[model samples]
Target: MPNRQAGISFCDGPKEREGREGRPAVNLRTLKYFVAIADAGSLTAAAEAIAIAQPALSRQMHALEEEMGVPLLQRTARGVRLTQAGVTLYEAAQRMLDEAQRVKRQLAGPSEAGESRVVLGVSPTLSRVLVPGLFERCHRTMDQMRLTVREAFTPELLDMLEKGMVDMAIITSMGASADRPLALHPLVGEPFALATPRSMKMDPIISLAALSRIPLLMTTLHRTVVERQLRPMGVHLNIHSEIDSVDAIRELVHDGDWCTLMPVSVFKEARSDAGITLTEVSGVQLNRQLMMATRIEAVPSTAVAALREIVLAELARLNRLRVFNFGKKPVKR
Candidate 1:
């Protein structure tokens, strides 16, 4: 079982549990030293890089190998070469060090007198519409807060949230049950729409059957969502192109007669463009839940809390304006 309070999953691997048999425990500092040496190819160089004595670096490596009961390195005239075991240990050590740094960043608090910094992850589908307003709001109201925005796909954002690389993320539902490590706060159910060239003669609300007859460009990531919702109703996607970038999809639909199916959020900024028009899907109410996800183990800083408030307020404002054709009003929780 994971340590819920600390958010650390205990490993039961034999190498991880080697200390159970009265062996000296291997520490992260030691792993860091070993990785440094492995990367530098010489203890003398590694020690200088890490600001440690060369002999001390050697001693730590010796102790680490002893703890694991394996010979990890072989001395060479030019430098040191990793043995088979050394290669394995080095890979694992590198991952551990990276994860450690990520955790440290996640747990770091604002300085005593400086501006608080917060990292927010936004899914690619919503970044274009959400980021500019979010950044402007933070700059106008929260002078003491600094924000870093990372735009990625929903799966990538979820992974970053899990690894403590991001403080909070806005992601679309993938139809999976909620994960224990994450606290999901529902924002809205954004409805899907048909994006067509402005010149195309289309109904005010296009049905799945009507969309199927048109050549379509759909996002590969969101295809699953459409499949899940429409496949059961015997509607199949007639995808002409599988593009990942929303901007690319929009450009394609704008330049050609091809139409694409996507969330109305994608067309929010481009609604005024004479090249494209958006119509809600009619036969099926295809939508995905948009939610804010934060690590369950995280203790939010003042900046993070403030940013959350700003985001929720902005989302509510957008909801009131019917900006993205959210299927229903967001319920206050």
Candidate 2:
């Protein structure tokens, strides 16, 4: 038997508890209120996020506290804090709420309409090149399907796909093993280029050998390529600084003060945006394979098919555009 003194009861809600009559329909709202109170460190901020009035949020919190027979939130002059009991339950409430929303979306979507929702991931590296245009094209092609996209690093996206968070991912990867459990569709190869600021106003590109004395901005790729390519050419670079972001490296290059060797996909956009130029080093070319990777197709959801088609179409369009000169002789892997 349950302890009556602990406030435990099967019918947890407002109004009549002994009978369903006059009882307000209660569910996870109480758990959500407890979460809000804990995060806001007070009732107000949490209430705002939850779109409930502060006092109402407080009331929900109080009801939840009473149901648990434990004070979930502690009030002090500074505001509110979660009690030890509240902290433990809040973590569980979060996962429950997320799964509930996931189920709700599945139920609300039409089952017979052949319209399904697909969630996919794109690496930030590719987002810069494809995002705006991809959105326009997907709408025209898959009007019935609801498409969703998320951006993260390749490793992060891979984790999401493995964890069933996303259906597929478009990314740049180097030699993902064949034994790995994934389906990879080959896309155009992303090549490398040596970009320099347009402000230099240099003549029609000369051999990379001639520009060896120039100060190239060091990016991660330089270590991968230039150390091998440049040393042999007798080029002595006064590398300006080691930076990470393609955008930042572009700024340094576009300013006419620095140069860097980078993959052409990144170089392509940075060149257009920052008014920079990339020339094949006249000796070395490096390209990373770009592709769409997915787990084995699920129960044939239309949304999944639509998303896969759109992604494939995008890859096709890029290939047709010949934007990266993938036709250039393949570099030795």
Task: Please report, in order, the local distance difference test score of every candidate based on alpha carbons.
Answer: 0.77, 0.65
Residue-wise C-alpha lDDT for candidate 2, range 46-162, written one tens digit per residue: 888888788877776666665565766779999887779778878777656655666677778775776667777887657766766677887787776666788865666676666
TM-score of each: 0.66, 0.60
Worst 10 residues of 1 by lDDT: 1-10
Highest lDDT against the true fold, candidate: 1
Residue-level lDDT of model 1, residues 1-333, one tens digit each, is 222222123332224333454555676777877888888999889999999988877877886666666788899998898999899989777657766766665578556777787789998888877888889999999989878888888887887778776788988886324654788898988888887887876667877777777778888878888888888889888888798898888777777667888888787663434566778787788888899988776577677689889999888877775767834335557
Query: What is the overall TM-score of model 2 with all chains considered together?
Result: 0.60
